[model samples]
Target: MNPMIRSTRLALAALLLTALAGCGDKTSPQTASSRAPSLSTVVVKPETAHREQVWDGVVEAVNEVTLTAQTNARVLELPYDVGDTVAKGDVLVRFTDIEQKSVRRAAQAQIASAQANFRNAEAQYKRIAEVFSKGLVARSDLDQARMQRDAAQAALHAARAQYSEAGQQVDYTVIRAPYAGIITHRYVHVGEAVQAGPPSPQPLIGLESLKDLRVTVQVPQSAVDAIRNHHHAEIMLGDGKRLAASKVIVFPYADPKTHTFNVRLLLDGSHASLYPGMTVKVAFAVGAAQRLLVPVAALWHQGEMTGVYVVQGDSVRLMQVRVGERFGSRVEVVSGLAPNQHVATDPAAAARYLSSERAEPKA
Candidate 1:
């Protein structure tokens, strides 16, 4: 092993290491340049807007009445069924009144008999008084005659009162509608007996006016204050039509179980298609506060997270957001967003732009 020969071998080894390092650097640059550039995207300018709160509700008739029987009797006939339209004073039901009629007739006969007895007693009393005045009868006899006449008059008056009471009982057999409306329910059927007074099962006949419809909504305790203060809201139908409502009446009491207040809205006009118990979506404008809003196309929803893409300096950045009320084709951004920011309308193109930016090397 000569010294000069060993030194030459070391030099060659160092030269080989330098050549390998140069080759590695050259391969890295080529690999980076081979990646594609990111694509461009369209941007949308989001605006600051106010959002409304929507609540679910049900439609009902403003005027509703329940009919009940006043006396206990077998139902003889029911002229109308459920869903039947009835006018005021229309006969809705009829009970068997034959026995009542017979009682009335008996009362009338008693009145007549009493009246005849009163006439006879009156004539006898007058004749006796005349005799007494002419000295033909004593004072005691005249007094007895007068007493008989007074008793007959009292009997006649009692009989008359009995007849009137019997007549009223007979009238109760026929049930009539109190107002013009459609019959929503019929609790009694033919031959069904109904009892009067409390604790007795009473018949229920439901009536409602379809001309005026109303909606009742339950507002959460959190939103009750808003409803009480503003009293302005909007109703959205299934078909996407919105009705503006400025009148909202809040029930003073809140439900103990739900802790929500009941609110009723009077519809402006009669909605023919609307029926009682129909579910609807209601939106109430509690306060006018500005927030950020964007179109639905600009939003991207993933599992448990919602976000949008904003174009910034030739690249797109993903932004998480909290959504609020929806106004037609637009939605309110409750948080994680700012006004006047340019968001990418197309999410796919925006993603491509982001990926390309990451792939590019520093200038």
Candidate 2:
């Protein structure tokens, strides 16, 4: 055999062996570090969570009223319309005052006449009493003058009362808001006829205060006793906002039809963007429990899929989780996840890391 041919065969055989070794390395399993890149993560652990009985509640204003017509008049001016905010003592409606003013003036005139008659009767009685004391006039004349003076005094009192009442009637023609609130409804319009009386007075306007708000919940009879004893609750609003109730009120009697008792939760101060007739969830603290909690930001969603990027040693994988009630920034993982397992806190960062890892060439 030639030496050059042997050397060339040996070189070719070494090249083939090297190629086969490279292919075998590609089929081997990847280590933990090679599967996922580094990311900020948190450990899943159990926390003390409050166990609550949640019920649907309706929001209502603490100070709400409907202004009704107190006197017969034609509505001349309506200064406010529905959805208008009003200050205390602001004029809401103004009615024609011609009839009321005329009555007031007549009563004033009557008062003046009554005052003059009473003055004259008093003067006459004094003169008659002095004359009778001096034995210059009969006793009957003195007695009659005294009686006339008393009657005149009584008539003057009646006239004054009538004048005051007439003034009140005139005041009733102009309606004013009793407190600061939003006008929810305007039942009477400008130039509308409003009557006050027997069957039912005409509703003029409706007002509700937004500053002081309360949530009304119809609780079942079984839960009423517990709620009454506890008297602690929180109102759940949109955007994950929770408000604590300042006070709780439970009605003694239950509804005849539903067998539910009325429970009211009064909010402390002004409610942020809360309005009447809004449905909210009220959670009453009943007990406590241990729950596996993870930051809400860790949860990932893709169409119908929901899971978290769980970190195992140096590797991170998406694990589907069954979540229960949400507690502020954290959520309870009911199942599909175990305690002490680390999860990526920043889901976007984890996703990016995973993408980069998958795109890299395998070792």
Candidate 3:
């Protein structure tokens, strides 16, 4: 063979060997066929016996009363404003009582006049009766004197009753707090005329007792039965404070539109800072049976729904699950999941890796 030809062949052979080595290096350990993707998992198991359902609610006063004006008059004075604490029987507001005072004064005058007339008539009647008894007066005359005396006495009693009524009407003009509470609202200011009777009588003030707080929660109709029988509840304040309530009261009927029932949880008196209109979360211990649950990380939220990836053999299967109440770190799985199922902690990475592995041709 020619030496040039032999050199060319050697170069060609060396190039071929190098290409084979590079191919082997690329396909050896890091190839999809050789390496299986690693995935993190969270084991599912039956939750502990203790479980509770948490619901959102708002804090409310135990006793809330709306104070309205009792007499139609211009607001003369408002000693208390919103957020002012007052005691029972405390005069919170006052209306113009000039007319009531005048009426009372007139009644007093009438009573005095009637009393004087009664005394004079009684003295005249006594004299007349004495003369009649001594046979110095006719029977008709005595009868007329007795009638006058009776009429005067009746007039005096009527006047006294009218005076007492007027005094009570005057007292009603001053708006007093029905109970010890904090004034939450004041609608009337000086010179505002308020109607006394109902139908449209604007409440002059709003009062709420702050010593004891309550939470009103709207529970679904399905859970209404459980709440009715429930004896205790837990309340979570807006500030992250947790409290246990001793009693739970459920409304007898469900709302027609929402199909939900109103439930109230009474907080212990120690939680004085909780006031009306504060938002809160309430938890009721409705059921005690055990159920399967997993860490929130194991579940994936997609759009409006949630799902989890179950590890089966070497592949992960997507599962749609219905979730129930969340109990701390773990959430209850109401359906579509079984106990002891291995759920992928990171579903996004697991799915991608699984897809890559399946795409490669098998050996």
Candidate 4:
């Protein structure tokens, strides 16, 4: 080969090698930046969390009553049925009032007759007293007129009492709701005979006020002490809503048969929309403990595996974690996560970053 040609080939090969090295240096920074991208992360720490003890409970109305008949009569009109909402003073039941009306009228007539007789007797007694004072009549005759007047006055008093009692009976014939509530059950239909007596009063209807609600829980004997002492609880509704109890009433006595105490948790007026007889979860705050917490958005669920992206320097890794109760936006980390570890706030972005990093070829 010629010396000049050999020199030119060598020079061209060296230039090509130098250009390839320069391009590699420029692309290396982009690859490094893509592998270790910035991610939003939070430092895991222990928080003061309440250890809740949950149990099944039943909902009941605070103001519930079973109305019974107070007057003997046949059912005439039943304007309201079960599940019907009623306002205060609304007529609930109307009985056949024919007999009651007749008795009331008779009492009114008796009162009138008694009044007329008393007025005549009073006039006679006044005339007799005047005559006796003027020495025109005997003392015995005046005394007899005074006695007759007193008897007529007594009869008038008795008649007035009878009239009042008769009116009360008429009022009892039309039963009205004592408070605004919803009808739960109807014991009698129209045209049924109900009696008001000593043996067992007939129950007419069942009503419950929705505004005041309570959660009744039969707590086991072992947990009674803690529940009674803390006196703090929450009602877990079906839709994942939680309501704090306004008041906690632990019954003093435990059931003799079951040996469990009755706990009543009163709910505030805000939850009036809840219906009665609903099963709810009652979470009683038994004690407090330190627990690791992270945002629920950071969790990655794949089949049965639950994990989170933990940021380690410039790399993100998925670590399986045992989760406890959910506290609003954050969740309890029972295990697998340590304190002060940086956790990626967004799992999806961390996952993408990890995928891209793994796909890159090794230098």
Best by the TM-score measure? 4
Candidate 3, position 14, lDDT:
52
List lDDT for all candidates, in order.
0.75, 0.84, 0.77, 0.84
Q: What would the per-residue lDDT of candidate 4 be over residues 62-95, giving only the tens digit for each residue? A: 8999999999999999999999999989999999
Q: List residue ranges in candidate 2 displaced over 4 A.
A: 1-47, 292-363
**What TM-score does each of the candidates earn?**
0.57, 0.72, 0.61, 0.74
- In model 2, what lDDT does residue 69 have? 93
For model 4, name the residue pairs that clash: none
Q: How well is each residue in 1-363 modelled by candidate 3, as lDDT tens digits?
A: 899987787677555433322312323221233453477877788865544677888888878988877777898989988989999999998888999999999999999999999999999999999999899989999999999999999999999999999998799788888889899888889999888777766778989987777788998988777766656687765454457786788988889999988998877658865778887778787877788887766776654456777775444556668887555556778897888888878868765765575577767
Clashes of each: 0, 0, 0, 0
> Higher lDDT: candidate 1 or 3?
3
Clashing pairs in 1: none
- Model 1 clash tally, residue pairs: 0
| Residue 318, model 3, lDDT | 60
lDDT of 2 by residue, 84-137 (tens): 999999999999999999999999999999999999999999999999999999
Better of 1 and 4 by lDDT: 4
Predicted structure 3, TM vs. truth: 0.61
